[model samples]
Target: MKAGGGDGGSSVSDEEWERFLRASLEGVPDAPEEPSARDRAAAARRPPERAADTAWRAYTPPRRRSRKGWYVAGFVASVALLAVAFAPGGVTGLFGDDARGADAAPLAPESVAPTAPPDAGPEAVRPTLAEPFKGSPAARWADGPAGITVPEARATGWMDRAEVARALRLSRDFLVASNLEPGVLRGERPAGAIALINPRQRDVQDYLAAAFRSPGEANDPVLLFSRFDPAQARLVGDVVKTRGRLTYAEGEKGAVRVTADVTFVYPIAPAGGGDAVVRTIVRREVVMSWDDPAKVITEPGTFSLVSYRADMTNAGCGPATGRLIPSFGGGGGGTASGPAVDPYDRSTSMDERMGAAGDEECGTATRS
Candidate 1:
């Protein structure tokens, strides 16, 4: 091959690069000083450099280098093409493939949003609001009616006409049971039963009869018995003053199924007559059940017994009449009920609260 020959990265000239390569390798072999002459002389040099150099210059280098550059460029172009073709959808999604699309496509517009909780607001999700009870197992309580092991759930006490008669059999009986003296009862008594004051008292009896319909108005004033007779419970008094009505609220509180606070009044009747003579004061409450029975105590604050009840309530219900009463009880506040007198104002005697019956109230009216 001649001097000035081609190499892979360079084009071939009149003289192959072989001569130049040989000259270069042979320690800068001189060519003629004159341009043209020098070129010719350089071309006259012996065989081109090493065989490796000759072959490299003759064919391999130029093509190989150009192709390598082009291969790199092609690869870059392929990437760019991919980006351009799929980029409109989104850069991150340039691959144009979606694994979750099938499941997503069929849902309605509203369904796109996640499920919401009943209590949770739109701003955030709520796992649950019913947090479990904390503290010792003995102290914790639930949110509904507790266990039911007794029939006290039914009512207070039930009595026959005889029991009602005992409530007010004789004037002296009324005095003894009610802690009143003959002087106090027989007009000779200021604090005696009204029966002593009104015997055929039409207005008194009529008015007292009207009150029997709304027992709630009495609010467990008091119930004191005179003596048993085969007749209805006598009116030791009539409801006159009531309080705590505004506190008549009902709802499940903690363990209690139902709780309510109500106040009422009852008027005392003359010991001899069947008419109301004085008014009494009373405060009471109603409780249905508890959340934790184990922790339950038959105390005034823990639960309630249906010791006494009323005929009407502001809740728009007719007078509640039923055969129910408490079994065991003596005295209590806020929820107290029995045939006893109020230690406070003494306006309402114990007989009124207990649904006391007597001979005075007997023939006056029959049991409804």
Candidate 2:
């Protein structure tokens, strides 16, 4: 064939063909073979692209979670925990006595039922008498109608012997000072004697006031200074001397009983005519109810003369005469005459003087 053949002739130059073949084989390597079906399936399952995406995601920072959502979840968990802890039988059941540790002490049975103190017995409730009256001389006088009750014995102790003696002396001195002293009876009241009389006993006051009246009207035998008019009489001699012996006893209704034998002299000048000095002896027994000691100390006259009796004798005047001034009855009144006597005579007793003075002058004798 011609290299330049016309129409359908082949025109490949040898140099061009060789050059093309050399260029094709110059740097080309062989193609890899196709994978098997099993390998393709495993490759599809493994997804190389997914593994590459995971690796890329790991390198990137994760998205920030919402703080409010986390806070709400934590709060709900805390509230549920608190509810379990505070439920009635929840926490206590977990840590109660049965659940206590081995080192804890067991409770004792005696702790639940404690022992009581011993009883004081019957003697503690029994009543007792005061110390002074327990074994006193006054105990012998316990059998009278006005005998002291158990309650009375427990109320106050008997007056001390020295105190009783002093009171008796002071009473005797008061009588003499009030009656024998000049100008003492001039007033409507015998101030000195009235001051001593218990104010609660108005009858005693009235009886004392009547002593200043004429002889028959005066029922109180304790008044020895005047038998003639007390308003007109004057004291003629020295202050009268008085001596007394006293005994203390118990009386009903918490009273103190005093018995005294008193001796005194009374000297006076009669309003009508003469001057006379009388020596008088009297036995007086009286029941006195004292006020509370705290009150009596401040107000000396807080004692009441609940009952009294005077048995009087004047050797120069007459025989022994008696007047009982009981608290229950009213005081004595004027009495009728029985004899003629000198009103100022030291030998004349108050009863004799009053009997001679006339009923209008002296009060009637209430005592039998």
Candidate 3:
């Protein structure tokens, strides 16, 4: 009982209890003061070094994507740019200071039109065949003939005197080579005659063909001259001679008109008679048109005979002479005058004296 009462009495008072709680609080020291909401907001507002570092890291540029691929792409772009810059019209815009820009107005058509080139002048006059053949033996022979007289060749405008003379010479050569040449009597065709006349001239070709047909029963002049039928009539001697003189005048449209007086002398024998010498005189007129120099369709120095005439005479070949007689009558010979009448002036008369003489020598048909 005494122990129980003493234990009860030992219980602490309220003040003592209060002092104990205060002492415990003081001894523990107040828990550190918690930051207020305002303090926390201020702290957050301050820019911290760590926060700056974090921002810098976040904002840092990403490493360039595959520098190798970028370099390749850049190189490809540069090549393409160079190709475009160096093209024809492209170079003008890129390097020319005066070149118009893309936004500039286009040039007028008149300003950009191309200019024409200057024309070349006319061609020079060329030399003719006579220049090279002057003073030749053929010329001397040509002058030696003693039949009808021919007018001298005359050049006018672009006409060449030499060419006229050459044409005459060629005509003479064709006749002589075709009829008088020794081998031609054996049915040989005359290549020279064929070459002289233009085949395109139908009339002239036909005339020449008829004249040069093969020797037959017909008494054609060509056959008579060739003496192809020796049994009936033949040239007696091997000696056959020819001589001629010529005159040339200009004709309409730049054509050349030629007149030739020629003589052929030979000996002949009839079928039942003795040999006798024969002299034949002839006059020929021909018109020659020029050959195109730039073309080979016709031969150079060859001509087309637009007009032609022939007059003939023979001696020692008449009925009384007992020789092969030519049917054509012999006429008086003509005299030659120097130059040609002016072809440009149609009103100008031809030399009446010479023309009259030609008429007497040949006939009205031989008049030019």
Candidate 4:
């Protein structure tokens, strides 16, 4: 964050220089005669002088020169001191000090790149179809469902290794269906994913259906599935950058639970088409559990979706949470109301945020 040009050299006015000279010589005695080799020897031979003696008394004062002559010599000495102080490898040069006397070499102006102010967010860069994810962390992420990786399955306390593997696979299918499927991303009902949920969870099924039929804050389909209004924006390319992992563990009542935590990056351009592209981030975490199919009234491939959470960043805030609405360059209207959150930040668990029931606010984003 170094900034701005050097301050340039300093200058001393006649009045100021004179004042400096007077102050420096305040208690200094008149110039003493240079001791000859014999006189120096005699002085060296003498006993040690008192440490408390005034500095001016250290020198044997001789007959003082005329006032004008003394002033001329003192001025010349002061000028030499100034020359050394400003020279390369001198006080100013050694410290990278920018200030110097006017005649000193001008400091090479620092080639500092301009930076945004602390309160200001990253500069907005228009995205192109060739580089839809430019200027974003998503650029390095895996494209599409390839980024959603399932961890190595291991037997939980209640389920065998084979059952745990099935649970992991089921969770992965649900994620791909809900977030990355071409039909689902186009605002179509996520039939494949919905079907995967346990048929016995009637309440969950009803809620999912109502979210799409009658959209509102309580049941926003966009929170679960990534979709954009076809009339507003089109996919920039076929790829959607993504990254996350799925883990399996034992859940209540001897069931194996697979949790998927992932972030999806979607790049879109205006539906009419052009080079402008914008990215919308969707982070979803879903928990799916498997039990004895005979005991839980479950099918072979389906699992009970115990719980889930999702957060959409760069998606504008308002009553339009039903579907993702990508804000194009300088387009879309909505005011953010809280602290900016970095969607790429996966260091902390999303569970902490989603669990806080009262913490939802339409804030800003550090970047798209």
For this target, which candidate reaches the highest TM-score against the unseen true structure?
A: 4
Query: Model 2 clash tally?
Result: 16
Q: Write the per-residue lDDT of candidate 2 for residues 87-124, one digit (tens) a residue.
A: 11111111111211112232221111113211222221
> Which of the two candidates, 1 or 4, achieves a greater TM-score against the reference?
4
Candidate 3 lDDT over residue span 1-368, tens digit each? 11101111213343453343234222122322221211101111111111111221222111100000000000000000001111111111111122111122222211111132111113211111212112111112221122223344556534577766566666555455544554443333344344554443333433333333321212133322332333333443333333444555554334454543333433333434542222233323333444433321233555545433233333212112111243212221232212221111111112221232223221211110
Q: Lowest-scoring 10 consecutive residues by lDDT in candidate 2? A: 66-75
Q: Positional deviation of 16 in candidate 2, in angstroms?
A: 99
Ranking of all candidate structures by their lDDT, best first: 4, 3, 2, 1
Candidate 4: list runs displaced more than 4 Å: 1-125, 330-332, 352-355
Q: Please tell me which model should have the higher lDDT, number 1 or number 3.
A: 3
24 Cα displacement, candidate 1 (Å): 99
TM-score of 4: 0.63
Question: Model 3: clashing residue pairs?
Answer: 151-247, 313-330, 332-361
- TM-score of every model? 0.17, 0.32, 0.37, 0.63
Backbone clash count for every predicted candidate, in the order shown: 66, 16, 3, 0
Cα lDDT of all candidates, in order? 0.19, 0.26, 0.30, 0.52
Q: 215, model 2: CA deviation in Å? A: 8.6
Off by over 4 Å in 1: 1-241, 245-254, 274-276, 285-368
Error of 2 at 324 (Å): 19
Which candidate wins on lDDT?
4
Give per-residue lDDT, candidate 4, residue 334.
55
